[model samples]
Target: MRLSARSQRLLSLVALLLALLSALLGGWGYVNDSAAVLLAAPLPLLIVLAFVFGLSQPDADD
Candidate 1:
């Protein structure tokens, strides 16, 4: 798949936010001693993967 540079940048930003949210969730879970929130680890990982894929794609014009 190919994506324009602008779209790739946007996706990367979103992915960064997802990772931040995941970290926050883990912190909250730690504070409250809950394992459930920490279980959401895979979600951010998936987002990061998507970000990597987006970066790997060529621009539409290329």
Candidate 2:
């Protein structure tokens, strides 16, 4: 199933917000020496990168 253009944009925005939050947490973790928080940070970033890449690709229908 295909998402509407608006929905896709919304999802992208949300993913970006999550990425920003992750970065902030990662920085805080680094300062606090929290290994768990540091390790968790990359996951959201990877997810956001994957999402943005997927959005950038042409759809099969196109």
Candidate 3:
């Protein structure tokens, strides 16, 4: 589904927050020696990259 500009921004913000959370989780897992953090890390990094890139583009309406 296509999101409106406001929705796109909101989604991007949420993605940013999730990315931070994932990083935190990775750090915590590292201290605890959990293997799952490795898998969890890249996906959110990629997602944050995508959302930031998408948000950086000029608005179609502008």
Candidate 4:
């Protein structure tokens, strides 16, 4: 299924927000000495990157 341009943009925005939240949580965890949280923080960033990469790709129909 293809998303409209607006939907893609919205999805990207949400992904970014999630990444930001994850980073903040990671920072908090770092300050608190929680290794588990720190390790998990980067996962959302990877997901955001994936979303960005996927969105940047040209549609096969193009």
Candidate 5:
């Protein structure tokens, strides 16, 4: 199912925040030797990339 424009924008914003948080967590993990955080680091980035791509696409009705 497709999201409404507002929802899409919100999702992209949230994804961006998650990506930044993940980066911060990754850095913290590296400094603290936390393996779990390291493993999770890429997930948010992947999510953010997906949302960014989604945001970049022209809307279906466009």
Candidate 6:
């Protein structure tokens, strides 16, 4: 899928926020195992995958 420049920028920002949220949640979970397992477990991986996919997208001009 191709994204416009604005969309690309928006996705990048979203990816950044997701990463930060994942880290914060992971750290919080580390101090509280239950929270980590229940809340932060899949977020980091999911965010990473999203970032990868977003970056891998072919350019619209391509």
Query: Global lDDT for candidate 3?
Result: 0.62
Error of 5 at 12 (Å): 0.7
Residue-level lDDT of model 3, residues 1-62, one tens digit each, is 34567766666676666556667767776534254454445666657655676668777799
For each candidate, give its TM-score against the true structure.
0.47, 0.47, 0.44, 0.47, 0.45, 0.44
After superposing all C-alphas onto the true structure, candidate 2 shows an RMSD in angstroms of 5.1
The digit string of per-residue lDDT tens for model 2 on 1-54 reads: 445667767766766675566567666664353654554556666566657756
Candidate 3 has its poorest 10 consecutive residues by lDDT at: 31-40
Local lDDT at 2 for model 2 = 49
- Which parts of model 6 are misplaced by more than 4 Å? 30-62
lDDT of 5 at 37: 57
For residues 1-62, what per-residue lDDT tens digits would candidate 1 score against the true structure?
Answer: 66677876776677567567766766766434244345444656767666677778867799
How many residue pairs clash (N, CA or C atoms closer than 3 angstroms) in each of the candidate models, in the order given? 0, 0, 0, 0, 0, 0
- Please tell me which model should have the higher lDDT, number 1 or number 6: 1
The count of residue-pair clashes in candidate 1 stands at: 0
User: What stretches of model 5 exceed 4 Å from their correct place?
Assistant: 29-62
How far is 16's C-alpha from truth in model 2 (Å)? 0.4
Pairs of residues at least 3 apart in sequence or in different chains that clash in candidate 6: none
Root-mean-square deviation of every model: 4.4, 5.1, 4.8, 5.1, 4.8, 4.5
lDDT of 5 by residue, 1-62 (tens): 45667876676677567556656766766445365455456666667665776768777798
**In candidate 1, how many Å is residue 25 off?**
2.6
